[model samples]
Target: MATKNVLIVLSSHDLLGSTGRPTGWYLPEFAHPYYVLAPHVKLTIASPKGGHAPLDPGSVEAFKADPESVEFVQTKSALWENTEKLSTFLGRAKEFDAIFYPGGHGPMYDLATDPDSIALIREFWEAGKIVSTVCHGAAALTHATLSDGSYLVADTPVTGFANAEEDAIDFSQYMPFMLETELNKISGGKYEKAAEDWASHVVVAKEDRLLTGQNPGSARDLAVVILEKLNA
Candidate 1:
């Protein structure tokens, strides 16, 4: 059987915390999905501007010290290379069956506003493909629209990086607006969260073709749902 192609969306920002403390993409968000999906699918990583996507140092540090994390890291070596540019991926996204976005502050700054991302999402969903986003990565969803000219997430029971999670890390002030509030305001959807931190994740919506994760920790579960929906 031909391997199914999965597009992995990553953040382009390489900054630390809002305090310039050096933050990058959450490592677990990348590792969990990569490991979970590798055995059954071919994966390609993408970023808005392409090149090297940054990893949150804090996330990377934890991955370095933990044995289980390190084991997963060694198993998924494809992530260490530079990802494809978002523009290029968007142009050809239809060839894939699944598209996923990992969480990190970088997405809030770029994907949330990138026209290419919005178009890619619109195309993916309209084509009946499985779409997934975790943590702040759901910021990309804020820009997606439906075939009826409505926000794709409007009225969808989805979750992402929440206000409480931001507050816990003291990064709320740096965010232009909380993701949950912004998603609710734009789509008028009933947003939900598992708990205070990004560690707690949930897959709130799983209709025909959409799968969204609340935070980093949810990435593994999110991939499972995506693979199931695709194979089903």
Candidate 2:
């Protein structure tokens, strides 16, 4: 069988706090999936804003402490150093077998509302390609519309960065909106979550080719499920 081609979207935002601390894609979100999928498939990295993707400082620290993540992080090809801009990729969504959105607070700020990103997602969904996102990356689904002009997630059970997890991370106060609540309001579908910590993850729905991960912890698990679908 041919190798599956997957697109991993990262975050371009560089600022983290009111003090202007540096922040980018959460390290584990990218590192974990890249390790699990790259050995078996061809992976390409891109972002909504494209160009040099940013790395969240905290996630970087976490990666440094773990040898496997450190190894993945050092691999130049996997680092999202340069990427196709979302606008350019939007017109070529069919080239990929699946698209994975790796989460960071940055995605919440950009991916959620970008028209191009929304259309890209709808394009993949309509083509019956696998679509998955973890943590705040799930926010991107907010703007995806179905053929009936309704929200794509309107009836699909899904999950994202829960309010409790946000609170634990102390980022809830700074966020413009809560992902879990917003997804619930838009979907009207049951939204479930794991415990308060980020180590737990759950894939709440899978119908046809659509899949979603609850939080950063679910990143690899989500990728594994996507791999199963692509291989099948």
Per residue, candidate 2 scores C-alpha lDDT tens digits across 42-155 of: 988888677788878788786687776677677764357788687888767678999888888888778888888888888888877888888888878878886779887887
Write down the TM-score of every candidate: 0.89, 0.92
Model 1 lDDT tens row, 1-232:
6788888888887774456766657788878877778889988888877777777778867678756567755664456457778788655757999888888887888788888888889888777788888888898998788768898877777788888878887888888668989887865767877855656666646465778788777888888887887788
Candidate 1 has which clashing residue pairs, if any?
16-22, 16-23, 24-55, 24-56, 25-56
lDDT of 1 at 227: 82
Per-residue error (Å), model 2, residue 221: 1.4
Worst 10 residues of 1 by lDDT: 72-81
Point to the candidate with the largest TM-score.
2
What is the model-wide C-alpha lDDT for candidate 2? 0.79
Model 1: CA > 4 A from native: 16-18, 71-80, 195-199, 204-206
Give Cα distance to truth, residue 121, candidate 1, Å: 0.6
